[model samples]
Target: MTRISRRHFVVAASAAVACAAARPARAADTVRIGYIGDFNGASLAAVATDQGLWAAQGLQPDLKVFTNGPIQIQAFGSGSLDFGYVGPGALWLPASGRAKVIAINDLGQADRVIAQAGIRTMTELKGKKVGVPEGTSGDMLLRLALRKQGMSVNDVELIRMDPSTVVAAFASGQIDAAGIWYPLVSVIKERAPDMVELAKNADFFPEIAFPTAFVSRNDVADDRSLKVIAVLKKANAFRAANLDASIAVTSKFIGVAADKLATEAANSKFLTTAELEASAADGTAAGWLSTLNAMFKDFGRLPDPLDPKAYFRADLYQAG
Candidate 1:
């Protein structure tokens, strides 16, 4: 396995964000799509754009890549974006009525609590330095993992760091454990092959779901929003069938090497069109959103309880 340096990932992500910020003026008919770069679920927009799926549907897309969901939400506020693909951390924004969730892209399975070989269980991490990106899905996972062991964030010496920095700090022995997600998890394993996994998102599945979502502003036309979802459905099938090709497209779009992205790509499992609709119809999607809403409030990231149904527009999918 080849190691993807922290500096390389940071520089690439920064450059991509800069380019998106400096993008040229869009045409009147352009559909601005904002997404988090280097993320598997959000990268589907890149796949659709590079493969000309949006154009094939007679839609003109103005793609903007951000480093995270909060920043992308700012674009939505400014009316700069018509749609967005965001992680679970930003689910509150939609549930709170900032935007409407048009689709559930995928459930997250790559987040984990990785520890050194000597630390075999979550109990062993007591008082040990654990690196995590605060207010992220990784942070939520870390707290949940701790709670499962009858512990809390207070029991660990929490070291706040971005995902890329978490990789570097963990690889250098600066941190004893990490609450992080893949592609970066893969990077850390490449650098420190002896690292051990203490817990993962899948460990609490069915009870908890960390899903990425596609959202549209309340003012966007229903037809246009449905078209975006249609393009994503096509992109999902294309990605599932042509993994290498999809990786190549995303690699070029994000400035990451295809080989480095391969592991991350393999770790992801996107929901198909039928699966997405089923999750919505069966109340699985609502349950996931409700979980996020409650988690955010518990973490003090949200001020009040918001109904997940307020932002979830499952009717649009049924109409399409």
Candidate 2:
């Protein structure tokens, strides 16, 4: 995914805060966001920003696009951002620090692993050289997949490469199998005629883990966060209600053609405002976090366990 910073923008910056709750945008409420460049399922921040929904929540947002989740998560820690989007990996790591999942974005069909023609299944991938970007969702997904097939990362030749380079490597036969996300996965198929899906994220992780959530820095002002949360809810609602426009925005956001995303958009799911808040209170998301943390530890990805209650907050926003 391409990450562009100069294109980062602010909306309705001059709007007054006097009636912020009643109206959108104000000079005083500006929330900087660290957004990862991804498909329609994971690009809600880009979609919402493009739709100017943040302004409707009485806040202006400075959107910094990132190529991956860890760098985006770093923005929140650096205090350069108030909120951001990330996969479960970044949220689970100890380094992320107090960032909590505010909303569950896409549910599935966002990440997968593809193999050369002869390799038809995850089991066939054993002894094969597999490629994944270290520390990214691809890496986590690959790890989960290997475990499911009663294999270990040690069972295959693990090649840590950037997603951008994975396709080329696969084409050159540097790796027999690789975990990747769309439209790169799409591109891999287009370029490598031999590329075939070996496994998808849903094959192992929970829908909760597949979620690309809006996570906020713990220190963000409550009033500002409430307003930003309102925007996130509204934007999520807008996505379901005005999908065509949302897709158009997402296409530009991710620099992909709308037609390709249209197919993927149909496969994705968003955790509604009701669903997110309910999960927060019901301990569903928290439970998933605990399970995910444990899996990360079991896989040797994380050295220690993380507290789900401390990391997940369903109270961040109310339903629209």
Which candidate number has the best TM-score?
Answer: 2
Q: Write the per-residue lDDT of candidate 2 for residues 1-320, one digit (tens) a residue.
A: 23443233222332433347667533656677777655643457766778777767767777777666666667767788777777655556532355666666656556787899878888888788898877777777788888778888899999988778897998888889887777777777777886787777666645436656677777866677677777777677777678888878888886888876776766566666667777767887767677767777787766776676666666665432
Q: Candidate 2 has what TM-score?
A: 0.83
Give candidate 1's whole-model lDDT. 0.81
lDDT of 2 at 77: 75
Global lDDT of each model? 0.81, 0.71
Give per-residue CA lDDT, model 1, range 171-266, as digits (tens): 999999988888778789989999999998889886888898888888999888888878887887777677788888888888877776776665
lDDT of 1 at 129: 97
**Regions of candidate 1 where Cα sits further than 4 Å from its true position:** 1-28
